[model samples]
Every structure is written in C-alpha cells, then in structure tokens.
Target: MIIPAIDLIKGEVVRLHQGKFNLKRKYLYEPLFYIQKCLKEGAKKIHIVDLDGAKNPNKKQINLLKEISKYQIPSIQIGGGIRSQKDIDLIFDLIPNAQIILGSSIIKDFKNVQKWFNLYNPHSIILALDIKFNKNYEKIIFINGWQNKSNMIFEDIIEKFLNIGLKYVLCTDISRDGTFLGPNINLYTEIVKKYPEIFFQASGGISTLQDILNLKNSGVKNIIIGRAFLEKKFTIKEANLCWQKE
Candidate 1:
C-alpha cells in the first residue's frame, strides 16, 4: 500500500527533518488539503503524525485529526500524543475507522500498550520502530519524536511488540527519513524475512516510484510516501498508475 503522509504542526501541514520538530518546513496546505489531494491522486490510505503531540504528550491537534477522519477519504492511521487508553478511545470515538499508532509511549509504558490492545483489539493499532544506528553500527530505538534513544536493539523491540500481538509496525529508519535518498531496503527485507508473519510498514527514504516498486517487489506491502508528494517529485496518481501497470 502506498500511503501518503500528512504531518501537522499547530494544525497546519508541515514536514520535519528526520522527525525533528525544531527543524521543520511548513507547507502551504491545510490538513484537509492533503486528504482531498492525495485521495484525488489515488491514495488508498493516509499517514498522519501529530508533530505537536509527539513533542508534548499533553498537547494534541485532535480537532484537526477528527476533521480529517470525517472525510472518509480512506483508512487512516494517526500517531503522536497518544499516551493513554482514553486517548485511543477518543480517537476511535471521533474517527471510528482509523488506526491508533503508539510510538514513544510504548517505550515508556509498554503495559498500557498491551492493555489498550486487549481492550480495543490489536488490529486497530500500529507500532513504530523508529531507530538509528549507534557508533558501532548497533541499531537502537529512538522515541519521543526521535529525541530520546534507547540502548535496546531494534529487532528485539520488534520481537517483543509482535509477541504482544502487534501485527503492523511502521519500521522507520531515522537516518533516511525525509531525505528522499531511498528506503532502507536491506533493513526492511531482513526484518520481513525474520518476521514473515508480521506486516512491516516500510517508512523513510522513498524518493521515487522505483523505490516504491523496489520495496513492493522485495515483499514490502505498505510504504509511506511523504515529502516526495509535497515536493511534487511524483504524484500519488503516478504511484497508483505504476502499481496498476506493474
């Protein structure tokens, strides 16, 4: 699935560098704009990250998210500012068809992740394994909007989450996100091979249609498309067309 991304800051569409809010470039579009535009371009799903909520767990742009969800453009997955079960409940109550993403909170409070999944069902939640390589090339998970780093190996984290009934993981390589270089094909391919039963949502570094095709051909079923769409490097329309002909 080629899912277009719509990142919001102060309720406006923007793109951050490697998921960093301090260094961000605001785009000239509303949250609704991407919903309608990406859908027009044949997007089957959309990825929305609340940069504001990621930065401060207490804050959120839920109203904006609610508005976007009401459009029924496609199945949506939302992340950031999702700390408790109540938050998840609110999202589901307001946007019934959306998936609630758990990122930093899972690192800080994994018990809640299990509890929420048991309560709301694991099928509606998506986990993020946002990671970076250490000096010795050891993969470490980063959370809290990519500001804090954990000493845990990336694979172990994914294993633990999958054991807890996590099926869809947004495995993002922070080093390549928003860079438009290309996705970490080797990383995703390896992870998929290791966890064939789980669905790994390939994120970060998708620059061209070939990148999408490469990932798809390599067994990646879900790919997140971000800055490329905002930058006009390729249209969602083109992406869908490629998918059809290929």
Candidate 2:
C-alpha cells in the first residue's frame, strides 16, 4: 500500500526536513494536486498531518480537514493537535468518513485515546507511533512532534491499542522522517515480524523505488512517502508498481 503524505501548514502540503519546524519546504502542488496524484497512483489512503496545529496547539485544523473532506479519497488518516475529545469530535464532524490518527495524545493520556475509540470504535481510530532514536540509537516514542519522550516500549503501545479494538498503526522513524535518506527497515522489519496481528503503516525517508520494494517484501502493510515524493526522487507511477508487486 503506497500512502502519500500531505503535511499541512496554513492549508498547504509542505515537507519538513528531519521534522524540523523551521525547515519546511512548501510543495508546488496545491492540496488538490496531491489528492488527485495519490488517487491516480492507486493509493487507497492518504496520510495528512496538520503541522501548524501540532506545533501550536491553538492553531485551527478545520481548513485542512475541510479540504480533505472535499476530496474523494477512500480513507484519510489525519493527525496533529488531536488532544481533547472535542478535537476528535471536530474532525469527525467535518470528515465523518475519515480515520483519525492519535499521536501525542495517546502517550500523554491513553484514557482519552480510549475514550475516543470507545465512542468511535476501530473504523475511526489509528495510533501513530512517532519514534525518535535516543543516544543509544534505540527507538523511543516521541510526542508533540519529537519535542518530548514517551519512553514507552514499541510493542507495549501497539499492544495497548490492539487490545482496545484499534487495529491500525502508522509508525514513523522521526530521525529518518523527511530526510529522503532511507527508511529504517531494520526497525520496521522487526515490528512486522514480531506483531503480525496489527496493521503497520511505515513512514519516514523512503527515497527510492527500491526502498518501497524492500518494505513490501518485508511485509509492511503500507508505506508513507514525504520528502522523496516532494523532491521527485521517485514518481507516483513508480510507487504504484511497487504496490502492484505486493
């Protein structure tokens, strides 16, 4: 599954190098451009992150959600600034057909995560496992867009979501996110091997057609691309071939 990214800031798809707030690069494509491209590329879903809301909690998320709702994409997994139940409600209200991704909020308050899931159920929820490698190079979950550490074990969080009837997970290697270097396959491969029960969506630094092939052969359920697609490192047509091979 090839899931294209639409990282939004003030209502446009922008790529952030290494997830750095100051290093944002806006794409020439309008939000609609990415939607049409991903759909034509045989993408069943699209990953849209609200960057502005993630950095500044007070920032509004309606415009981004509105734009997504207008698109005819099958499923849209959206995240960033999704802290309160009200925030989740607002998103669902705008895009009732969308699947919401809860990131930092899950780490900070699992109960709140549960509350939303309890109300909305599996179809509406997905946990985004945003990870940053520590000094030891061991992957550690980060919240608030890599600003704080959750110090949680990888499967521990995955298991929690799984037990609560949430079956989808969108994991990212923040260290590799938007770098266009390469994905952290060793890390993803291990997760897919260990947890065959949950659906895994791999994100971060998937720069080439080969990288997509590697992920598919390794059993990754889905792949999310950012910098590589923005930088023209690979074309959507090429990415569709990788997914077709799977």
Question: In lDDT terms, which candidate is top?
Answer: 1
Count of clashing residue pairs in every prediction: 1, 0
lDDT of 1 by residue, 1-246 (tens): 788999888988888778777778888878788789998888988899998899898789877877776697668899997998888889888878889888888788877787887887788999888989888877788988888887677777776777668788888999899888899888888888988888889889888889888888768778888899999999999987776666
Model 1 off-target regions past 4 Å?
none
Writing each residue's lDDT as its tens digit, candidate 2 over 89-145 gives: 888887777788888888888887887777886867878888877778666888886
Among residues 3 or more apart in sequence or in different chains, the pairs in candidate 1 whose N, CA or C atoms overlap within 3 Å are 182-205
Lowest summed lDDT window (length 10), candidate 1: 155-164
Give the best candidate by TM-score.
1
lDDT of 2 at 56: 68
lDDT agreement with native, every candidate = 0.84, 0.81
TM-score for candidate 1, residues paired by index: 0.95
Model 2 spans > 4 angstroms off? 135-137
Q: What lDDT is obtained when candidate 1 is compared to the true structure?
A: 0.84
Clashing pairs in 2: none
